[model samples]
Target chain A: MHVTPGQPLMVCEHCDAVYRRRILARREVAHCTRCGAILERHQWLSLDKQFALIVAAGIVFIIANVEPIVQVSLGSSNATTTLWGAAIAMWNDQSQVVAVLAALTLFFFPLTQILTFGWLLAFARRGERAPGFRQAMVMVHYVRPWSMIEVFMLGTLVAVVKASSYFKVVPGAGIWSFGVLTLLITVFASHDPRQLWHKTVGSNE
Target chain B: MTGVVTARERGLVGCHVCGLVSRAKHVPPGAMCPRCHAPLHRRKTNSLTRTWALLIAAALLYLPANLLPIMRTVSLGNVDDNTILSGVIELWRNDSWDLAIIVFVASIVVPMMKFLVLGTLLVSVQRKSRWALKQRARFYRLVELVGYWSMLDVFVVALLSALVHFQVLSRVEPKPGVIYFGLVVVLTMLASMSFDPRLIWDRKETDD
Candidate 1:
């Protein structure tokens, strides 16, 4: 039952509810009585286990990028496209702005998030502060909202369903990897990235 | 509830990025968070004006996003321009009621709700209305929660457009409306981000 206390006080970002910080027991979560926003939590897993999840997500992300997301077969001449291939295909097809938007939300932002968290965890593993820790933490916040990997996954499913009627569309390996990556990322979200700032708790990993 | 103290009341500012509380009696405006380097502020600066600006832009684009054709399909040389609502109807007519509803809600219902809920929040905060502060706080969270889903349509358009490029059988291309719809999603998200929910409680705290 090892645990580390965070700052002496905490404030709810969503509702401005403040509380005297509590040392949470393992798997326990404290919610703001005022607005019911989560104030703090004792994460279910330590940093090491969480870092492994992020690494798995990273590998899955690469597979999602490289493999074909959708394969179209019409009379033996089939076309298969990966996520990157889709974005590049769109780029060359005259809708460049939409292409960039698709690429950024689906690919670039998630990659940055995985790499940033991975970097932070590597330093935390050794009980040493990561370089540019402040910038990295801030980047996590800004990037969280924009990284719509799960949204992409859902939208991709929707597209696949809608397109199958008109074409011989088969869901490819990339789509399944995207589903797995979405689940891994959701697990990552449950940990609350800000918890990484607690040096004592982080060192417990 | 009677004697509760906020972080601000004790001269402590919480780092918005990391949630770390710090004494902030003499720090300059826009002081960076000591732990995370995010700018610490009592409240988001000009939250209302910025929110209103983005909301107005989104509102302006919403019409075109829904009216103009978002996708063009050429089947055997017959061209068809499909707007968002029409796309939903096409899906419905094609017997995909679930996908139709999903697209309808994500692309249409979600943004309209953001504009209305956010507009209400902004006006309520500006009017210093003490009505339903807790519910309003929840609404702010709801706004943030649903904002990203609005991008569903844009991604749908991008993916479908990326596919369906067959030379002779059929071709689907993204039209002007998707870009506008995409911009609307982005703007509303920004507006939601800029409008600080803390303002909903400012008036009540000061009355004490």
Candidate 2:
């Protein structure tokens, strides 16, 4: 069986003229103003780049969860907690809502999104079209809001400050790592969407 | 009633791109034309109302978030209560200035910035103004991106509260600020969601 690569095609709304991706990118306007036809719209990223980013993000994510996020000390006592520790603590405190929210938003959702994106991109790079491309894309959209590590981080900071009067507080290495991870996820996720869409749907256009 | 059918009715003049009404008749389907390629719809779905609802909720929550206590810590048979700012100050006193600053910025600064920036954007779009389209979009993205950092304060509190729960020696309890902080997070997220990106483009188009 012969497999053909997906090529970029732009269909004009007004003139119905189809232009190649390169041609559309060079033009100032993506659509014909006079006839109201789409002058340019095409896929932009290749499979290799998508897979590389997914792998890099996954490694950072693991580091974020495993390391100590912050350390606290009261007189002679000191302790540290990782991302998982925070989740477990919340559950034990009977704040099940907060615990579940923290778990899903900070850990579970991001993990699932990263794994799914990586699996799909890796498979697609090898010329094997993954089943349920659209479903995976929808899952990405759903998981996007639940990736709340950054928010959780901020809340932790506030809580630490408020608690400092009685105890000494220190930001652990995990805090810094988590910050880096947050930035990485934001930038990578934004870029990844465009790349993924291009790989999956732009090729067909 | 007695007139003959025109060429326009024969799909000759209809828009070739979006399939809207056109004046010309028998315009070849493959032929590139202006009207046929125009956008089918450019407006957002109830943009103003949605933005207002989000902004109002944010404004309402912003109050309790600052007023309520975020964490309560007990140590050496003494109970010391503090809010978000006090926490930062406490960290500063402990020589953890860097961590203090981070907490302050993430918990206090970022949340306030989200409210101000989002409120401004919402108002600007409602007025259909064309000022600072690119800058506004950047601000919006920044707010959305940083909104989650506020959770740090909550996590730290929960963690400390758990670790220090050593019955007579020390115990830390979550203050009312946890609820407020959670509200702040939700409100900010809602604010970001309510402000439509398309509004930025719409105003830009109007200006152009």
Candidate 3:
């Protein structure tokens, strides 16, 4: 780890261990010498690549929202529900808390995060700072934990399997869209998001 | 090891928001990071108190979350009510052991482990044991990673309730227990976030 002149210092978020920031080659990672939390990583995706993934996820998000998540058939009658319809049905069931929770986790937070990323990247791509960059970054951190898309996907699969024992169930286009959205979002997250703090204007480094 | 220095000893606080290392002592009241304009604090305020409160609330709710029925299935005049545990058994009895294990771990095992691990970390930090510091830090990370998976069961209940919506043939309805279970998961998640792992490294001595 060769530190450059006027090198910036970084303190581990997991531990308080401080170290001078160093230049790393592509695909290299810097681990905290203390508690072993990752300090930095050379992400595989460039800004354009990540931006593309974000856009693709945004499109898939729409499809996931609009299409039916699953279709159930019982004798002569059949039913299909989208994520929005499900949340509304949940609300109609009189459990406002669960309804809101379902709405926020499965729909609202992910949408907000995507919009925030779009706003942040619009400016960051040009070597500038996004308006409300601080709030945006904080939202990203907080919302990432609560979004729960992949978890929702797993839940759908489990629900399908459990429902299969009782009746005819079919996973729908929305489930496929959700699957794709999960991969795109995962890909974006795997590329360390903190790198944005370094790339934008007013960078400490 | 003897040569190691911390931001605290150097009177510097790295910006928790933007990673800018700046002097701590000289900053004016309500100082914000110059780069991102985030308010700077050496440590998160009321970390332990808040974590304990939330964890305890979650523990209290864990009872109803388990004891009462999470969801009920009504089909052809027959009703089957299942709690978190019984739901897993229902899945298993139906011969889906893989899903049974997944639900068992995520819904049941994960939250319990969080309570135990987080409770231990809080006690250890208060006592300042200075033992296995590295492992404690890793434990906190693990808690954060697995904390959200507890929501899996909640979603399963919601989707199941939403999909099987028919009067005569079959229908799924979330019971009051599902609400308590949802609260338990959310509370534990907040508890884990309220915890600040850096506290594990703080010492009372003049120097390490």
Candidate 4:
């Protein structure tokens, strides 16, 4: 029953024993089965690398938002719209679900998550463990579910094809950039969490 | 009293705090009870069942999404329906290389890869086979991470449907693919959710 840092603590609940730190990082399993017992708890992240990724992802995100994603043509009339423009177009047409979804998943959620993660990472890098680190981490977790920009992009492609019969839809530079941006963000986000956790914990200790 | 070794004496410990019971031998030096944050014993619960259920549901949904028509169109003079592939091809023909590639990768390649890779990992875990547990976990994580990208097609559809509302001149409507694509996303997400990466370590411990 004795607890101490640097010692692997196992929890037994319902006759099951599991390591404490693993459960904390994964945040799902929290009980042992055999004889229920409390387990170890640890949470940390790396500040420096996380900051770098945030900066890179932030710049790409800004570019993705500013550039036009697709160009549409009907007869001789041609027009293009950026990420935000697409959302506005949806809202203007009364497609509230689509508009809100587009805005939140593609633009809002990601923007917030990246910015928040970046801020936390920067602060942590300065050897300042803000009391709100846990709160910020929760925000990152919540935003993770909503950051579905890439998925929205796929749905957009399907929509374009269905609409092609009525109008000529052309892919724009923004679309391509956004596509790459989606891939980059996906990779960076996945890597950032694990790396940040390592860095933050290391620095704090 | 007669000489008797109780379960607890046999290394079976129960955490009164969280009601978790496990073999005392496996308990970590400082490990606490998972449920109540009390002390722990040796054995831990396996999370494979929950993860497997999730993965199976994902696999089930993945099938219909691919086979069904993603988009349905009703035009004034013509009726041209499109699937995910047809949509990508249209982009390619239109000289929208970037868009076409994006569509191909996000809607087609990435989702398909996720399904295959995740399915493989789940199957391997179920069989309790340890080929590349760490690598498999990493792959599962990648699939979970990238599962959202499949929404690219969906976003395009929503955007176009909203923007191209000129009425008689032209209009686009949601098709079955929107639903199917949504299902794909949901299924993959479920698959990711159901996967228990800890299963990988289970095999390692057993081997050790």
Going through the candidates in order, their DockQ values are: 0.45, 0.21, 0.51, 0.16
RMSD of 1: 3.6
Q: Looking at candidate 1, what is the lDDT of residue A15?
A: 58
* Top candidate (TM-score): 3
lDDT of 1 by residue, B1-208 (tens): 4555666676777777887777776447758776666787878878899999999999999999899998888878999999999989998999999989988899889999999999999899889998997888888888899899988878877787777778877777888898888889999999999998878877555322
* Candidate 3 local Cα displacement, residue B171, angstroms: 0.8
Residue-wise C-alpha lDDT for candidate 3, range A1-205, written one tens digit per residue: 1222375898888777789888889879899888889888878887877877888889999999999999988887888888877677668776667888989998999999888888888787887878777778877866888888999999989999998997799889999999999998888888766678878765443
lDDT of 4 by residue, A1-205 (tens): 3223353334332223344335356434343332222233233324565577678878878877787666778777676677777677656554555566677878888889878877777866875644566446546755777687666555556555645655678876766766776776765654423223334443222
Stretches of candidate 2 exceeding 4 Å from the true structure: A1-80, A92-94, A150-190, A200-205, B1-43, B132-134, B201-208
Query: Backbone clash tally for model 2?
Result: 55
Tens-digit lDDT track of model 1 for A27-76: 89898777766777788878888889989999999999988898877666
Please name the candidate that would achieve the greatest lDDT relative to the true structure. Answer: 3
Q: Give stretches of model 3 more than 4 Å off.
A: A1-5, A202-205, B26-29, B205-208
True contacts kept of 2: 0.18
Best by DockQ: 3
Which model, 1 or 2, shows the larger TM-score?
1
Model 2, position B181, has a per-residue lDDT of 73
Off by over 4 Å in 1: A1-7, A200-205, B204-208
- Runs of candidate 4 with Cα error greater than 4 angstroms are A1-68, A76-104, A145-205, B1-46, B89-105, B108-113, B130-142, B204-208
Model 1 complex DockQ against the native: 0.45
Interface RMSD after interface superposition, model 4: 9.7
Q: Model 1 chain A: which ten-residue window has the lowest total lDDT?
A: A1-10
